[model samples]
Target: DRGAEMEWISQYPHEKEILLPPLVGFQAINTRVERKTLVVELRPSLNLKSPTIEEVIGKLKSSYLTLLDILKGSLQAEALVGPSEERTELHESKAKAAEELGLQRKAHEETNPRWFNNALNYQEASTAAFAIDAKMATKSILAEMKTSGAYTATFGGYQMHKLGLTGL
Candidate 1:
């Protein structure tokens, strides 16, 4: 039953090929209908280097613009078809969807940069803390060896210090 429903929705002429904007560092992996809603999954594409924050923000803005354009076009098409109860309902739904999308875009623009900066700051602080801890651990080990009276011993008339550090 669910499969049949999904197939029907997908077969709708106007619903075919939802035009998505070009996205940087991301690609659409899959799309399916869950209940009455369409769910699309986007995965980050592998790259030798990551994109800058500004690039990410720009992509987001472009995608938002594309969505608005699609919604506007749909509204215009509906207008050309003349007035009917079904058309009226569809128009209202489209308007509400557009409004909701606009709100989401605004929220993302306001918060995403701050969230990214906080995450970067936290990573830097954690790395510094770990480095300091490692240094202290190494120093403590050296101090313990000194306190235990471990001294360089001579072998075959050669001082242990003469060997220095070596790797096999």
Candidate 2:
């Protein structure tokens, strides 16, 4: 049987305890290399992909206050007509801010794995220690949010369901 392969003749595969994090909600292992090491990854999964902060914020803003957006946009358009020097200074300030933000994001990304979301694991573990089902806790929170009614008005439904549980 293939079970013989589990005991490698060379280097032991489990010599290094690789922790497949609960992050990204691993649907399937896409790749396996057998030489001197083992590496696992989710090649093409939506859960593995994370929308940039800018993209998520933009999508949320667009989905939430759509009518207000049109009105505010028109107002901003009318207000955009300003003194040339003032506009030039504003443009320069925005450019500088954007550059700074880019540098900070780059630095953070160097140490992070596409926002792997290890924070949620802490709370889930804590709840588990207390004998609480994380799923039921999430449902309770969703029900409370629904009763508040703001979540339904914002993203329709199911948008916030698996947020903390999965990667994206």
Candidate 3:
């Protein structure tokens, strides 16, 4: 039956204990005709103890890394197609995701700077994060393109960096 064939792909880990949030999952329906995709957005259960601000920040960082891995071909092939033609789309999507992650991370930082600082004080440097910033850096790209008349729109807030564009 159609109902029996529906499957949901979880983006974030789901713990029996709640409190942790921003949970997200996607539902996909495959049939003889075409494919259908839906986002299973969940408001965190929020049952567990309130996590310290640092815990949320750490989760955001981990989520970012997980997404980076997803974009870097680290996930199961069946999960994310990562097609060549869809590279740009994937890259752009990741950029937006990363931006959201960064904003959340920054919000945590603002609330608990000391905890955030201490948590990251001992962590290893994120090379891929830095590289993604470099490859996807679009401020200068847009500036140069503007002068060349290649881009006409005024860029406001944009996170245009991604590892998928390294070859390009």
Q: How would you order the candidates by lDDT, starting with the best?
A: 1, 3, 2
| Model 1 CA lDDT for position 69 | 53
TM for every model, in the order presented, reads 0.25, 0.22, 0.21
lDDT of each: 0.46, 0.41, 0.44
Best-matching candidate per lDDT:
1
TM-score for candidate 2, residues paired by index: 0.22
lDDT of 3 by residue, 36-90 (tens): 7544433323334666556765764555455445444422232244665654544
Model 1 per-residue lDDT tens digits across residues 101-144: 45544555544444434556435533443333333333334444
**TM-score sort, best first:** 1, 2, 3
Candidate 2 lDDT tens digits, 1-168: 111233354367665333332223444555687897676765322343666566554542333234333333433443354665555433343344334434433444433332324556333423332221223344445555676975642322344444643422
lDDT of 2 at 144: 53
Candidate that scores best on TM-score: 1
User: Which pairs, if any, clash in model 1?
Assistant: none
Which ranges of candidate 3 are over 4 A from the true structure?
1-47, 51-125, 138-168
Give residue 7's lDDT in candidate 3 (0 to 100). Answer: 24
Distance (Å) between predicted and true CA of 2, model 2? 16
